[model samples]
Target chain A: MIQAVVILFSVLAIGGALALLLTRNVLYSAFFLLLTLLGVAALFVLSSADFLAVAQIMIYVGGVLVLIVFGVMLTHKTDPLNRSNQKPNAVLTNHRAWLWPVLLAGSMFAVLFQMLRQGNFVLLNRAAKYQTTVDTIGRQLMAEYLVPFEIAGVLLLVALVGAAYLAMPERN
Target chain B: METSTILIVAALLFSIGLAVVVVKRHAIVVLMGVELMLNAANLNLVAFSQYDPDRLQGQMMTLFVLVVAAAEAAVALAIVLQVYRHYRTVQLDEVNDLNN
Candidate 1:
């Protein structure tokens, strides 16, 4: 059942990613990106990374996607109905650009496939190990990794302030 | 069912991300590409973490990556919006004023 769920989640993730890539409407792409993030969060849960999953949903879907949609809204003056017309000629040019991504991605996959086949990964039965619960992760975050955790928090606060400053309209 | 499957999925996600970054001219699309790449890395981390019984460091790192990715997306989009206000377009080719 777990394997089945993994397969299903992978399918969802890949599908949402593909949607994000193929959609021309920026809003649609953002929504699909949300789907993709949520699917990955589900995968994290399946992997027993429950805290990470919650963080993923809260941060990426809730925070990042909102930022992207706001960016779209602020940048584009047209309503959704007319925004499609604003596609720059450069985007429409080079119709064969799709082939480049396919080729590049294919080569990357080939290399990674070879590496994975050669590597040694010991897979243990999930039932045998003690659960990696959120409590343990919280304890570790507050202990050995405390410095980095606090540093990350400070970094995020700085980013928030910087982003607001950069985004504020210039005064006349 | 095997580790190879996780690797394959990760590779696919990475490639899709690369495609989005390379082929799409919109700044938001490029940001999506970055997000995809980050997710690919997170997937790899979780897959590797599954191999160990103790030390869920891989999962922890994935959490950090997600947080950083969110921060990156927020700042990047804010910049993109600011740029659009000045230039009216998000196409990379046209925004050449900063080019030396």
Candidate 2:
């Protein structure tokens, strides 16, 4: 049963990513990225990382995706000479240098697959214990991982200020 | 659901992400590709976290990664917007010049 679920989401995630690559419209690609992020979150749940799953959805789907959509909209180009191409969501890209990159990605995948095939994970011999990880994560954030946790907060604050500063309109 | 299967899926996802980043000229879409790659890594971490003694370390690391990724996405989008404002186009290939 769980195997079926895993396979289903795995297909969903990979297929969504492929669609995101194949699509030409920037908005459509952003929506497909939404599909991929959700599928990854489901995989996180299957791996017993419940907290990570929730965090993935909230941060990736909720925050990042919205930001991406806004980016797509704000940066969209409307050709004044071409009347039919002025649609805001029709931000279609025409050309890409696909030959070498696809080749490199495919070769990289082949190498990783070959490497992983030869190895075995002894850790998989044990079944994962599924439990609520929120408390453990909370305690760790306040305890053992406190330093990094504080650093993460500082980093986020800096990013927030920096992004705002960068995106602000020019005073001149 | 073998661990290898999850890892393979991640590999495929990562490869597709690489293709997207390379093949797409749109700046925001490239950002999407980067996000996909990050999620692939997160999946690997979550899969292995299942085996941790207390199951705390892996997720903890993933949590940090999530925070960093969020910061990255925000800053990246901000930069993309600035690039568009300055260059009048978001296609990475078109914005070859540093100054307008």
Interface RMSDs of the predictions, in order, are: 2.5, 1.3
Top DockQ prediction, candidate number: 2
Q: How many clashes (backbone N, Cα, C below 3 Å) per candidate?
A: 0, 0
- A133: Cα error in model 1, Å: 2.4
lDDT of 2 at A40: 89
Docking class of 1: medium
Query: Which parts of model 1 are misplaced by more than 4 Å?
Result: A79-96, A123-132
- Candidate 1, B2-69: lDDT as tens digits: 34566677888898888888878878778888989999999888877765535677877877787688
Q: A133, model 2: CA deviation in Å? A: 1.5
Q: What are the root-mean-square deviations of the candidates from the true structure over C-alphas?
A: 3.8, 1.6
The residue pairs in collision within model 2 are none
**lDDT by residue for model 1 over A1-172, one digit each (tens)?**
7778878888988999998788777777888888888888888777667777888888887888887778776676644564565574222211126887778877987888887777665553334232655776787788868888988898899889988898899999
Docking quality of model 2: it rates as medium
Fnat for candidate 2 (0 to 1): 0.83
Which regions in candidate 2 have their CA more than 4 angstroms from the true location? Answer: A85-89, B53-55
lDDT of 2 by residue, B1-100 (tens): 4577888999999999999999999888888899899888888887888788463788898999999999999999999888988999988899998668
